[model samples]
Target chain A: MNIVENFDLYAPRLINKKELLSAGHRACQGCGEVLAVRLMCKALGENTVIASATGCMEIISSMYPTTAWEVPWIHVAFENAAAVAAGVEAGLKGLRKKGKIDDRYIKVVGMAGDGGTMDIGLQALSGAMERGHDMLFVCFDNEAYMNTGIQRSSGTPMGASTTTAPAGKISSGQKTWKKNMAEIMVAHSVPYVATACPSYPLDFIRKVEKAKATKGPSYIHCFSVCPTGWRCGSHLAIAMGRLAVESGVFPLYEVENGKYKVSSEMPKKLKPVKDYFKGQGRFRHLGEAEIQVIQHKVESEYQKILDKVKYLKAWD
Target chain B: MAKRVGMEVAVAVAEAVGQCDIDMAAVYPITPQSHIAEHLSDLVADGKIDAEFVTVESEHSAMSAVIGASGTGARVYTATSSQGLMLMHELLPIASGMRLPIVMGIANRAVSGPLNILNDHSDIMPQRDSGWISLFVENGQEAIDLSIQAFKIAEHKDVLLPVCVNIDGFQLTHMVEPLEFPDQELVNKFLPPRVPYATLHPSKPVTMGAFAMSDYFTEMMKAKDEALKNSKKVIIDIWDEWARMFGRAYKPVETYKAEDAEILMLTMGSMGETAEVAIDALRAKGVSAGLIKLRLWRPFPFEEIRAAAKNAKKLIVTDRAVSFGGPGGPVFSEIKSALYHEAHRPAIYNYIIGLGGRDVTVKDFIGMVEKVIPYNAEKTVDTYEFWGVRE
Candidate 1:
């Protein structure tokens, strides 16, 4: 049976009563970034305003006169979305002081791609977190700068093929490992930090809701599989994302005020990282030796994360 | 009671910030502008000012923290110079676009390549188009006075925009001068409580700085432009009110010895005083040179400039900054544009001088006048030229 024919198997009912990200966006078909955004907006509802950085999501959603965003949305420059959101949040509070606005539960959220989050926007994000603004920051990690034609970004995984990090005679693609942004955010000692992937829609939605409920500086790092950059079949987007988590490549976890909790633990021996890498063309050039090295690294990192959670629990 | 005290312009600016009801100041010290932030930090630490003072890692972070603090409905301030100002260039536009009304002190310094950190207008000249109200203060008194006025003007409902109070690096920012410190109660009366039009509040939430689509993008820019243009009139009214209360007047262009004068010298910031000395010397020689100091840069005093230069036979425009391979300087081009369509316009000449604090002595000013007079006599003055360059 075709995938659409088996809709009951794959199609989850959208529970978000409010539609902040409207349908008919100009995002490319099967764009995982927009899917993540849709899920986040659904979780945030209409009471939130979003400040978006300049990227593929912003370009496609806001096309002059018409916008895919049902909520109040602003697209600032690539690196200053966090700062702009801070200003909006400040402006809101100032207005409230004068009793100009009626009291209502409202949230300010900032959304940006990996290029914006891990690189150019790092300082602004850190400053906002440090200031303890009542805000939520969401980073959609697509591994590469897919909007700018698949250039390499700090978030691009090691040995991954990108336009700038192409596999050739002198080098394996993307020599550097992906930046540990979740850990970096947790180090800021903010109230909350969590990692989620769109492959598990419910889990991603739950994290957004948790971030919204948090009082100050909640960060949600979302892993979004980019079919264009990953060189994977569009149909396998969700499957690849799922495999990444199941193989312990990208663990689902949350850190609350320096306390760690691993939400999904691998019970049996996790699947080899090779199983996850073999499907994507970005990792096609990896030999068996390199694959073994990647697997070892993934397993070791996963253990360290589990140990952190255990340590925090022991102290508590 | 108001009291006269001798203070550096940078110190005056710090004092102004200290006396204001500022809730927070996030700053990273940079050359020529460090004194302002340093003094403010000391004041905060000494309990002279009750404010959250953050010493940030970089200019970018300083601006970011200011944005964050300002979002919390706190009055915010910061300062930077030269390349530090360039690093904050991206944040400047964002601050204004979001209409946060952040009041900043910019010590006008030359931008870097060979890495010179002395005096010039290059640093702020590039930010002229960044949707900020630029106020050029001539001395310590104006620096103190304008810094206080900036907060009031920026936070006005119709003029909700960021303001940059520019003081010449090393010249005005460093030089000590006597200033009349306004009484605290009088200041409190003149500058009412800040009522932020927008802020982050749990109750009655409003969306600001929203993403604009192509459909609404033009309208958004138009709205900002309309606010800035409308602010010009508001600025005039506020300055008038300030004069009424303080007995000291301010205008977009302040004229001195211009009546019945045949030659006019147009300048900004500390160079205005230098030009005044040159004018006085020229007048002593019966040369009929007068001075017009530009107090406002953004919302470019076009009408005031036109009226100021209307009676002059020759207008010599001096800029401490250059516009690269384009015009002689950024201000010169704007002044020329403002006068292009006027009837019976004076012969205008552009000169780039005193870059990187290369001492713009009265002799240099007189030399500029000498070069302009011959060109005016022949009615064949070149539009622009570098004044003191080796070439």
Candidate 2:
């Protein structure tokens, strides 16, 4: 946290030289998930045991006989990253008591994809937070099951064309709205919950440090862009993330204990939602009416967040 | 001084585990196995034993939590039965492959289609090849003895794998019997403090349960297989030590009235006690029948099975769980495979019996032994019939 600086709008944010992920990884070109993870690992330096769920991050980082992770990591089944992480936390607590080992500095982290965290692993994630384990769970939200060939996930945005929910003659794309996983973690009364994007590495790093500082369970939902799945060029990943934030589509915010505050700086007014949607072909099928509907929903959700911040700040 | 007290087997098991000085327990409530979880939580609440008790949401989480805990070099325990055991099917191998040495209690019950929450081996049969040390207990005393012994066996340096103590649901778990409570002093002497070889630590980190590619995957599987196979020696050693200290002898195979018998019957878990009664009745008649009770289910006790069947002309194997569409039962398939290369193997007949808590009387055992005696079991070996099954 002391080392991390504010996001410099005029220039690039300086990333740490100590790379936790190795030089060679199997992630696709312009894979924002790995970039987000690079920043995350920089925040949670050594002395962290990461229990990664089965998904793109796990698959790319750990190909047997080789691994990109320098830190000690484990990949159990898909639905139990948080559960396994909780076990690791409990295990350390027990070992410290019986083995007479000082493990105060050791931290456990759970990492999963949008499919793993929001869908298959939600129950384990919720249970871990409810039990109040000292750990961090970061959901690498690529919005779909990119590893399984662009299948729609619960975190997949509405109107995005996926393998399961294809853009058809009668249908626009995915019919369901994306699940609010950050709010779900917040409802668990978690000590810290935040939403950050890879495009904003400084904000992402600071939040990871905040979660690391929290005494109990903490969660970070990192909005990751996938060029291969989002039907964009490899270089457009960061631009997609920026357009998402600038258009008010994916607002960066944090909920500390109970109080809510938007973490990322917002402009005087938001750019049109069309600027964000037009970059990716997944939303190319959306008509003017569908675009308006999405814009209206995103604006309303953003307003709800603002109203909560205002009311909570009034007490302060 | 240890004293004998009448108590339910499940409670006795939890008490035995509490005496083991375990560090943590993560378990879910499942039918027939609920008593173990309930009593363990009570023990923790009463502060009789100092441990972290977590009531997980599902059996899957229970196993996962135990794996996590065990990976950190903590002595851990958990229990489940039937569907609960079935739910943990995916993580069973991970516990063993990681060499975590977790001790789990399986209150053996039938898996469902008809959905019966009663005594059967279906629960643990599916986990036979999960590279865990499996022991079946016949009664409350065996349950208590084996539950305590499981931790020692699993934590044995040479056998750094998971151990599962299987007691038949409702049959052993629900029954009350007079059992000797080993004071912490005796348990401490017999089962010394566990020394983990490696654990998750911030100081000296180690990667456990790492992914193995094709080049090393086969070797990894082989190593795990070898570990489980070699655990047989450790299991026998712990039983011998327990016998020397407590004066209750335990063996992979226990026999009753097998002296100069031409016909033999094999049973596992709680069914062994019932089959002994059948042997006594058959001896009352001129029929020279004997009984062989298998105590160790995994590692198969091949040498013991061969010796037990050496003198007998026929062996009637009874299984409570079905293999369905292939073999008559899981135990039967293993017996056939174990005795496949015997130079003087006896005729083996498998009887799928007492499924889903259907009561199998002493008369049923006598009848099965007699029915197999009439047939030339040598020709009938490797095949089976469903005993007491409707026409």
Candidate 3:
């Protein structure tokens, strides 16, 4: 007579609850990009079809005869993920119209890197939103073109040392500021647009859930820390991402059809930008003056974001 | 069975679209290709073609809209030229890789730099390797015919790939000719509705264009390769069926008076028709020369080319576009590579001619034939030579 005799020992347990991303993948250890994807898929669940642009996420998950994706997926090209996703959504609608498909709740998601999203894929993404397709576009931002070696992308932050934006005697690395993709999405007047980071998983998950719940087009820009390109330990990916949010370097926020709302609030005594920049090799070459300039820009942008949230809240 | 008269090639293409079973046409107008989109838009407005006509902002959006519309398993069509085609270049491979059977009419024009809007093959040549089944049409009738055939070829399950029907910009797209419009019933039987793989269905969901790690990237490419390679046979079958139904036959390589010919002239697009005039003149001169028109540029008619060049001692391949800094023109290099293993490969010489719509007269063709003489006499040829260039 054992304690097991007092209860049912062989009850079927719900072992695997994770949706979207499946277990096996080729992403490097502690890769933040895949982690963001995992969370996105988890929130999206199984009824979502993904149109992926060629990037690290695509390269790491899909290989010949094998895929880490549990759901149906497509890898179109580097710049047409949004376009392909639109096609999938349209195809889905056409199938529904013909009574060939019954489920109407299926989600169409497009995932691309910053280079794909902000540069090459921008027109397609803009078109999709303008067309008012029922889809979600997710841009996994690693700042630079990490998949093709550390080349500069439109989203690469100023003072970051990428291969294309190498610091030299005559010039500072990535002299331009990151492109405001969230604002660009808002310009489309899409139903939803949000910014999230892996550092704040719950907020990111919530934003995705809200996006899935919304109609028409929605965009989520997720800040994914690239340890390889950033010259940091893989384990520090999450820490770096957290620092980005805590330092207000990358703010957590959402915009609902032009209504802005900051999701995470920073303390008045937040860590300096240098504390965050010093952790990554990309900003290792930044001098005091450059760091000061970056800090000023970040502070100004963060205040603007805060003001927008306040104004929207007051209007609402 | 309805009859309507249209002069411009774009209007004729629009008429064809109206007559066919197309569900949607997404378009953004560019020079030389605008008439087709505009006419299609008019048809959509007039309730002639029951389809969604999306006027996108850019060529990129135009292609993107079509991709979305086609993904929904709808038979889709679009048109673009030169700079527009270049702008949509990034999406061409995606459309093919996703295996969406989208057909586009591309007006071949010279690319920008000099900002010319005239006819040439340079615009479409760069897209030769983008995994699309490229078909070159010489005139208005062929334009109408190929547009219809393009849909059938693209939607074929065995050949589920995108297709680009190349027509010379001002030469064909702006010209008018009598085209025998096919019966609606016949077209319906021929094309039917598109059946796409992995369409977004709510009940049984599927994913397309998924992220492939290195572990499986090669296999995804292999799948596309296999599909494209297999499409050659399906294309031939479709062409045969089309010929049987419409009494107009199309081959990957169409030969004119090639039997027992000693000299063969190869060309593509509208330039091929010009070369035909030269072939007749050369025949009159007792040169025993023939014209071989390359109809399908991709899935390149390697076997057909080899067979056509079998009896020839000298093959003069005239490419309208230059491959710059390379051996010969683009087409010649491809032809040479294909015939490299053949036992009776002929002496092939490449001539770049009629770039930016330079008038290629029968004399130019004769000059090309004359230039091939030294190569045959010496049993050696410069890989390529420019024709009609001042220098």
Candidate 4:
């Protein structure tokens, strides 16, 4: 038997065995964030550095003197991941000019949860994007601030129950709709922006791969189903993310240089929004009226994406 | 070899920093600090410097972006004023704790309550414990000189802490003066390219700014403290080298005719020049008055302050920032705290003056000395007083 039977390494392997994100992370039983990050690492390979804002991922992966990251990572402040990524990009540029780094340039990735991206970190995200840092900002949206005990975030969906916005007497839980992070990134006019989910492993990897390939700033809004935060079964996290797309609640799409394309194949008629909402206890309090309202809202948002895609398709 | 050119202090600062050939400059505009950012932007756009100039949405983002850029092992610069500085307050400690050697310019302006935008030490005073080495300049030449030196001080391996060059708002930032712009080759030789301790590089991966539990937090804090406390040696070294290369000299505590004076007056920033005029006037009248300009605000010159105050029977500390409900002013409280344990301490008196762009003249300094004579620094109960407040 040959010691290295699989020595056809000349071909670009789609499934890299070298896990840069690595194991031994302190993530929960069925963490969608870790899975997505794992795939992201697998896509970028070893030539990458990550700037993570303070959140679940930061807390889980980095401990003093013992880090889960096999690659360079930094967690500076709560709201400045994108800003710090901007700095890293500039710093690398300077170092590269002086021939201080390897010729194959390290890819910079900024990671933050929904709260870090949609609320406190919004200004920094906008500024980094506007400045066009040659980096990628990947936002893991688990609906609420999961690291802070499931508090409502700007990305929390309307009718979803969180610790702060619980469904109690005379309360309909979160009154406002979830912030459209992918559309927001599109609005920033970044070179590449996309919606991704860990459930769709290939799609997630493909988008992340595209982000690394794009020259300027790129953003990926990955839907991570937090079982602990969403009051769902630990094993249902992956299925939940799939439902988020299959039911048209979180349609998988991409925007490239102002062109929108729905990457996930949708049926002529998507399954009822209730199929996406019913499994989670956070939305168990919803009545027929509330469910209908959510359904309508989801339909409207999904239609907007479809309209953009059809327009771009027609133009092309 | 150098040539003298007359320019605004802010523009001169831009010129000075430009000579450093920084990698990136993240800027946000606020009044009194606007000209510095505007000029730097122009320099970057016009290819005067091959650096990145990012006009961020806000000062908070400016600080954050610079932090990011600096983390990438890039030489970075930024500028801000009053409310802008206040907005950047949260991330200031993070930058220092991470040991990122980013240089920033503070056009020292008063903080707002009634929304006044003018010159004062109010803006920089509250940031004493933010883990940044602070320096103040007395004039346009000093402004230009120190802006360049700030980067050197900050980038020192022993003192890899961020440094702030606090230039008085419109008083110094707007005024024009002649300064000798040094040769770029000389600057390149003096300030070498940065050697980052650890950065975001995939070649050799390491984690930075990791969360510290109680077990490790104390040690981290102590390391930062020791790095700063020991930085005075580097600061003195940089100043000495600069003086040799150039003709101008600088010191932590610069004295003006204090060699044979009993009543020593202390001031910081541009007020030092005006206080020097008052000292000349006092000497002419034979009142035994002298002036001491405190150039370094952080790593507070405890020993120098004691030695200067040792010979004097009385010392008057003129401050520009109020501490509100506690001590009368920030500088006054700091000096008092420093002198509290001294064996032979002078009768110290503090007067809050020149706040919110209010000017203090030579006569006001002379008046301040007269006011300090009545109150004994050791024996008196009421040591704090405000000067030139309208009735």
Docking class of 2: medium
Candidate chain B TM-scores, in order: 0.97, 0.98, 0.96, 0.98
The lDDT, on a scale of 0 to 1, for candidate 1 is 0.82
Q: What order do candidates take by DockQ, descending? A: 4, 2, 3, 1
- Model 1: per-residue lDDT, tens digit, B1-391? 4879888878888999888877777788888999999899889789887666766667876776576556546787889898988998887777777887789999989898879989999899888888899999888888888898898998899898888899888888888898898788878898876787755543333444455656777777788878888888888998998899888899999998987788888888888887888889998998888888888998888999999988888888888888878866888888889988998788888888888888888998888887677664447466687787886
Q: Candidates sorted by TM-score, descending order? A: 4, 2, 1, 3
* Counted clashes in each candidate structure: 26, 0, 23, 6
Best by TM-score: 4
CA lDDT of each prediction against the hidden true structure: 0.82, 0.87, 0.82, 0.87
Give the C-alpha lDDT of model 2. Answer: 0.87
For B84-117, candidate 3 gives per-residue lDDT tens digits of 9998898788788888899999988899889989
Per DockQ, the best of the predicted structures is 4
| Backbone clashes in model 4, listed as residue pairs | A84-B68, A87-B68, A87-B69, A88-B68, B347-B377, B348-B377
Better candidate number, 3 or 4, judged by DockQ: 4
Candidate 3 lDDT over residue span A1-316, tens digit each:
6634643442112112465566687777778988899889888877887888888998787765557777767776778788777766765664565565574578889989999999988987888789888999999999998888999999999999999999888777898999999999988889899999877777888889999999999999999999999998888998999889888888888888677887854556557899899989988888999999999999999999888977764323
- In the order shown, the candidates' Cα RMSDs to the true structure are 4.3, 2.9, 5.0, 2.8
All candidates: TM-score of chain A: 0.93, 0.94, 0.92, 0.94
fnat, candidate 4? 0.73
Q: DockQ, in order, for the candidates?
A: 0.27, 0.56, 0.34, 0.66
Q: For candidate 2, lDDT tens digit of each residue in A1-316?
A: 3343533442244445677877798889999999999889888887888888888888788777778887778777889999989888887776676655674678899989998999999988998889988899999999999988999999999999999999999988899999999999988988789999989877888889889888989999999999999999999988999899888888888998789988746655888899999989999999999999999999999999889888874223
